[model samples]
Target: MNTFIKSARVLSDGQLPKSGTIYPVLFMISISHLLNDMMQSLIPAVYPLLKEKFGFTFAQIGIITLVFQMTSSILQPFIGRLADRRPKPYSLAIGMCFTLVGLLTLSVASGFVPILVAVGLIGWGSSVFHPESSRVAQCASGGRKGLAQSIFQVGGNAGSAVGPLLAALIIIPFGQSAIGWFALVAVLAVLILVKIGNWYKRQLILATGKSAVSSEAVHGLTRRKIHTALFILAVLVFSKYFYLACMSNYFTFFLIDKFGISVQSSQYCLFAFLAASAVGTVVGGPLGDRFGRKYVIWGSILGAAPFTLMLPYTNLVCTILLAIIIGLIISSAFSAILVYATDLMPGKVGMIAGVFFGLMFGLGGIGSAFFGWLADRTSIEFIFQISTLLPLLGIITGLLPNIESKREVLNK
Candidate 1:
């Protein structure tokens, strides 16, 4: 852990990193991520109840997703850039406050418009949360960035997996008002983030007072090459998240329509898929570090193609199994991709995280809205059939320049 910090000899803006991976800070932030995303995931987990309570059409459902995702997507880059210019250690706690209010509002929301407003506020909180937290993860990486990112990402994935199950137990039966109970989660995240903020502030103080000792690692790629790589990464994100959006938002409807399962059962299946994804997230980073991120990115995205294509035609048990397989295979790409991009563009971890995460949310919104419109015209199964083809876009992974070799040379 201390190796990377010493070798990179720089964090960002001339800030020197501490000598080793800060396990306490990393685990603390992971806990905060779990609490944060667990609350956010509740929004989608409660969609069935919302649809029944409000008699919402598929299009309206899509619009709700759009509102939430767009709000989450749009502000991240700006916030990240601002943090890059001026690191705001305490902003994390402040952001969670929005989530708390949003939860209370969602609990009492009686109309569709109110629900939209509530989700929008929660999205605002997420926009602030992701990029800053990603920055924190990298800061504490001690140079094992892929491992650090995986640890950080797995928390959110685990929280995502748990959210639907919690909703099944708590909200599905108790009704929407039970959502207010999760405000306690937001409050807990805030307290944890405040402690993280103090640690971050102290790190900044220590680093800022030091004299310049070293510079960032150079990847030796030209500007044009770097830009082209970034564009490919964006396309890969689009492919990954767009397919994920369909599954996360509509897979429940598909299961209910096709198999006549109860909403609670469908939520359980969703939890299984998300749980597999969390497990997959754990391996992606260290694997990338051990092998090469390029191969991991390529295989992670493209590897799921067969299972996804086979999913729509399967029996209930088979479908559930296929979804879990697909989740595990495809979910590994983002960590490798993010860490790789940061490697390509050294010293811009926050901005890179913001762009990719924002693209993730934005593309997810567009994809959900598109699939909802398509499902209304055709059928849920039909949309899944079409959406399954999206992973084919992973073939474009071939276009990403191989920078891992360069990184190896630098390490040597």
Candidate 2:
């Protein structure tokens, strides 16, 4: 018992008398990120099922997604700033509570309106969770920011992978209603665990008579660099997230409508895409660290364009293979983008995370709406083709001035 308590304390506080503690914190942060991601992925995973059950059209479904994304994105910057000012664990705990409520509501709701309301709640919950949790991860890393961010991002991808498979399993036997109940129960369990961890962290601070360090205090990047980087990041994030949202919200529809695949088969492809993305997340960070972050970022942007363009033309076997390959190529840039954002605002990890994850994704929802509109007018193939050019724009933006020069201006 004593050993367990000691280990817990060490893990919670980001203290390692030796080198072994990093992995555990990395693992926990990853799991927490995954839980948050699972919530996001689960919604899309079951979109087809919902469409069947509720008789929603593609346009209406797009609106529903838009509402969720916009709400979440708009609120992120505020949540992120708050995370910077406050104790991160407390913020994260609050986020978890929102997630729990949203999931629980989703489980019991019976109509489209009710489901929309629940999804809105879930978006708010996600907005809360990401910024704060990211701050905690940065703190916990004790300075290996790149690796920490990568592992943390990978957790969300991992959850995305698992959510569909789990949904498929639950939906098959128990029905969609059962899946919601299962999600609620699972979220509750996670909430309890996070709360306990927060309580333990507070006790340790009391015991030691020292508070955890603020994100801003640990590292410093100049204001100018932050502004410049954010501008560039905003462009990239907007484009990247726009593409991701369209894929998540509509890919199943595309598979069904275009390829004539069963709903189950479409989901399987989505799972493959997410699973491959998980690998990209894992690979992207270290590659960034070893090579220059810029190269990985630009390379991914350029490399993924062809694949994105190719997605519309492929057969089932080819589409599955291409989706996985596209996942790897596109996702490889994700962690690097986060790292670059953080590097731009070195001390403001929470704020950067919020803006990038929350705002970008939210705005992407809006972009997704535009894409959906395009789809309505034309076709999914055109949407995919148009989106392929977006990353090239990102590659251009990434070529902006270095962090050092930007910092010099801020120092003035």
Candidate 3:
């Protein structure tokens, strides 16, 4: 009896601490991640309203998205380099400031030109956060890359889910003007958090007795690997953006035009898709750690392909379920991809994330324009069909020799 009790106590003790100690670093990463996601998700909720108010043609909307993406993409490599050299928290705070300013500007803007400018600023601000925050999170995770990244990414998904819903709640009754007030409040909140994060980082440095100028921990990859990885990553980015842009640029039209759904209902579907993505992000990281990152990523790609194909043919219930599934697969795949890219770059997590997140999302804007053109020439159905194949390509690429294996080959 005593032996049995002792064994049970041991098992309980092990499980208890596992459930008890929420890692503070993970919490911090999650908060920053949420902020980033919120910024990205907020735009779509207001985009349809903007189009009506501004009299934007499809092409014009494409251009606005393009400008925002291109500017942010252009800035990512530089921002990433800075994050590697400077304090990451400082970089994150700077990015937040840009977001705050952009939101404030957006709230007040009346003209198309000013709105474009505000979007660009917001994009640029968002561009900086991922690389720096990701690097810090990766460092803090002590090799639990998948779990840590997922936790960090879940925050973004949460933000994304909330941003659109919150925007809808505000804009539905109060009109677009309410968005400005919300932005003002959000900006103030972010500013306070940024200050707290900065101070906390300083405290960590002091506690560790480490100088601020520690040498870069990740280095020594060959140029060939770097180029190859970047090439593959760029393709993934393009494919990702292609699908994202199509959905973001046209999902509303697809719903209203094809299905006879109300505008509000379509918006709600978009929110549903994002909310599911957040859930997926939470699941993806841990799954990636337990399974191989490569396996989890490839599986997501394969899973997403079918959903994409089904989306155009489905009714409302099926479409929403598919959207949620797609969100899960894409968010999970991307989170794993982000962690994989950071692993490839090692000490250069910030730079890799900048390229992957910022450049990819930005480039997606360009892809969105192309999709818009495609929609103009052909039907939206064709656009959806073509976009569906992208994930298949990703699945194929992921099957190629692993990055680690490639590194070994290069070293030989």
Candidate 4:
């Protein structure tokens, strides 16, 4: 009787309803994403403070990022594969608890080893959070996968934008102990996620014995073609994130070094770039839904190349403007890329999201560490000049098959 009632109810009065775009769930999940990423963003946002306090070198800072990101990256695929086979409804909240503890530990961490341990815990939390959350986003997409992903992604972008600003205001002045306050954010996230978990549990019960929605591959592509396209997408991820790693981890240093700006002022500038990224993320998905993912991917990645190439030569004002433009244009590619990959190999949403998100963190980590090491050897400005060339690799987007149109035609 309970099973029949759930089937008839079909998702709590049209909120997570049976056959439409469940905006409520999407928005709620997006909020969780926002909180999750906002907390994560605090790590880099506090780097300057950490460096000054600990008298740490750039190389040490890079290793911190490497440790955090590697821990975040390594477990994602395995966790995602597990979730694909067996969904863990409450695991989201469970993961956030790790972040909560990490925050507390970081607040009191006195030495290098303690800081590393704290960050490692936070990374573990992120590793568990992303894959399942991504699977849930897709499950609730109601066929508007691109729009759904954009909605989900924009939250993280917004969080990333907000975090540094908050850090500049709070942690920079009050010192490390202030990090403890963010644990409250994690607590709130835990509460919200408990509610989401309840909904997810009902969804599992509702879905038992039911066939999942269609996730057929693009109709005309061979397995080899699919693999080739995925490889291209991976390379695009590398380009986009490697550049972003530079910005997120080191752009403030670039500004501080070149412009002689105050630390707080540089953080505000970083906020501008990340805020622009959030706005661009909002546009990327729906545009892909309306147009095709391939074009969006191609244009987004390549379009930023000119601006990036010009960035190293510009005045401070021009540099900030160029950074905004670069952020807006380049950031849009991620949603389109992820959606495109999922479209290529349907039904394995968990594993694919895990791989891509993992790759994103893993590559971003490696890039951060390399740039840190290089900056130690050379200079921040020189690295920026060299990294700008990465986006030129977007030309490879041409090699990606036009799968969306083909799929549409086949469906019709």
Candidate 5:
């Protein structure tokens, strides 16, 4: 026990140390992220079951997501800023406990109100979790920010893919009651986070002051240029995540209505797209490191347009194939865009991560709610037809100033 404590202190504070791409720590956090997001993914994964069980309208479903998202999205930036001032390493474990309770409560919830409460609890946990975890990944990165983010995000993407598959395999058959069993995953994550927290705590004590926002202000940018880049990044995030919201929340319905597929089968298709997204995420970061983030941003967001345009018109097999293509192509933008933004505002890592991630959730919530209303007024098919146009806004990518060359100069 003494050895364990001593080792923990050393590893956490300074022994292992942040150097060149700490794989072990990176992978540990990545796995924790997988567990964290896998649990989150369950919310959407069981939507078909939730709708049927509750006699919910599409709009109600949208509201459910909004509540969850608003609770999760709004708090991130503030918490991120606070964490920058005072590091709370153990907060990660405490956050997971919220999820554990929320999952258990969801298992037993009988009505819409209780369901909201449960999901809201989960969302609050998420709001606390992401900013800190993102910082942890960056701390562990040594210097490979893009690769670390990719590795971290791939875990989330994989978890997002797996959650639906798990829901289809486990929860769908056993009913919502089965969600209780997943609390074990939360427990497991807490254990991992406990160790990570100890390390983080030691780092805080030792930190003469290494924070997530070391490079908060870029070297050669005007305030106006910074704001312009940030706004552009936000627009790009809106385009990406909103389109994603349509699929993540409503794709099952689209498949059910159009192809007459089983809930399980539709989930399998969504899993395929999410899995492709994971692959894209893994590729994008490394590619950006080798190439340039701007090129990656342009290619990822714009290159996906053709497939997005084709999705609404395709048959079932073609639709599934188009989805995979779109996921693969478009999914690459996030890490690239995020890293680019971080480069733009190096000093505000926690704040920037929180803002972008929060926007990802917030925009997704709005999109889900909007599309849900649209679906009720028109059709799920119609919503897809309209959503396909969003990626066209990627043309604005051209307006982004070339920062990669600037970064290389700074590195020299």
Candidate 6:
């Protein structure tokens, strides 16, 4: 049913396909990712200002986040599913348009309802951006899927890290109207996506040749086994993102409460953790390409557990260092886990990306809300003590059957 489709051929992990890694295309995709996520990250950064200007409550603030993120989460798989069935070369560019409008809307929004609508627009844009762009990354990967993914992802992580700093510097000082300035960033993203879209269209034409083969299945897994593995992966994702939510949403609070640090100092400490995460993301994928992904997955998540367990008991210096350690180690697992899943389910790349990315967004949202409720019931320090236990779930990493070993068995 593939229209003028290239033969969709699948290979075992790390095997080179016919195409070569297109770094220019990869860099373009990565830059688009940076611009896209940077715009989205502005919402939370501006929340304090929004509260002061609008006289909004914490409850309303939560509602804003919920609306923005849920749109970002819930619509992904559907868009990905549709794109899988019907590949849209220009969808990336079209998606950026949504972000552009959202930025404009948010900049001028005078009422709470308008702000919600604006954020929802931005979220919907993100839901479209991630899956399609991920597929594009793989197409240009030259079989280096893990490396492509990490490059694409690290851009986002870097953008997320930078957005807050930019907001604090630019938007905070200039006030709400300054949100409009970010529309320029969105416009830059649109231009890059257009070029990527053209490249994707060319790939389509080139791929229509006989060298394109249909997707091959992962060698040894049964339907049941595949499902089981996916479920296990989801559980691990939950553990990683939920624990991350604790750090991302409330780590600053924990530092202030536990060490009586200034808010600015805590933010600096948080940035250190975030920067380490970006580095970990870049490192994990190339390592997965070299080592078996299962080992990387097992090590990345489980290796961080000891540090996480020690975190709550540490003083100021040790706490920051522990957080950085935990961030670097745990962050590596996601790229490995994501690449592993795609290797198992080769034909369903877009769907898998959608589901995993959606889960990350959804679980992080749930974790933030859950911890907020928990912190209310107990103390923030107590919640940190409890959140530290989530990484213990990484012990389940040992349960994942090695896909490479299974492939070897099938070949023999």
Q: Which is the winner by TM-score between candidate 5 and candidate 6?
A: 5
Q: Write down the worst ten-residue block by lDDT for model 1.
A: 1-10
Which candidate has the highest TM-score of all?
A: 1
lDDT of 5 at 366: 94
**What is the C-alpha local distance difference test score of each model?**
0.88, 0.70, 0.68, 0.88, 0.85, 0.80
Runs of candidate 6 with Cα error greater than 4 angstroms are 1-17, 52-59, 260-262, 408-412
Instruction: Write down the TM-score of every candidate.
Output: 0.96, 0.85, 0.84, 0.95, 0.94, 0.91
lDDT accuracy of residue 361 in candidate 1: 92
Candidate 3, which segments miss by more than 4 Å at Cα? 1-22, 203-226, 403-412
Clashing pairs in 5: 12-199, 213-347, 215-346, 215-347, 216-346, 216-347
Q: Which ten residues in a row have the lowest lDDT in candidate 5?
A: 7-16
Query: How many residue pairs collide in each prediction?
Result: 0, 0, 3, 0, 6, 7
By lDDT, rank the candidates, best first.
Answer: 4, 1, 5, 6, 2, 3
Instruction: Provide the clash count, candidate 2.
Output: 0
Residue 411, candidate 2: C-alpha displacement in angstroms = 16
| Colliding residue pairs in candidate 3 | 33-156, 34-155, 218-347
Q: Estimate, for each residue in 1-412, the C-alpha lDDT of model 4 and write its tens digit.
A: 3453333223211123456777888898899999999999999999999999999999999999999999989999898776766677899999999999999999999999999999999999999999888877876788788998999999889989999999999999999999999999999999988988887887778665554444456558999999999999999999998999999999999999998999999999999999999999989999999999999999999999999999989999999999999989998999999889888877667778889999999999999999999999999999999999999999999999998889889879
lDDT of 3 by residue, 1-412 (tens): 3332232222211111122323676677687678666765667677778888888776777777887777667778777766555544565676777877787787778988998898888888777777666665665565577787888888877887887777767775576666666565446546645764664354334324222222222335566765676577667666666787787667777777778887677777888888887888878778877765667777776668878888878787897888888987887877777876665655566677777877677767888788777777887777876787777667555533365444445558
RMSD of each: 3.4, 5.4, 9.0, 3.3, 4.0, 2.7
Q: Residue 303 of candidate 1: its Cα lDDT?
A: 93
Sort by TM-score, top down from the best: 1, 4, 5, 6, 2, 3
- Relative to the unseen true structure, what is the C-alpha lDDT of residue 87 in candidate 2, on a scale of 0 to 100? 42
Query: If both were scored by TM-score, which would come out higher, candidate 4 or candidate 5?
Result: 4
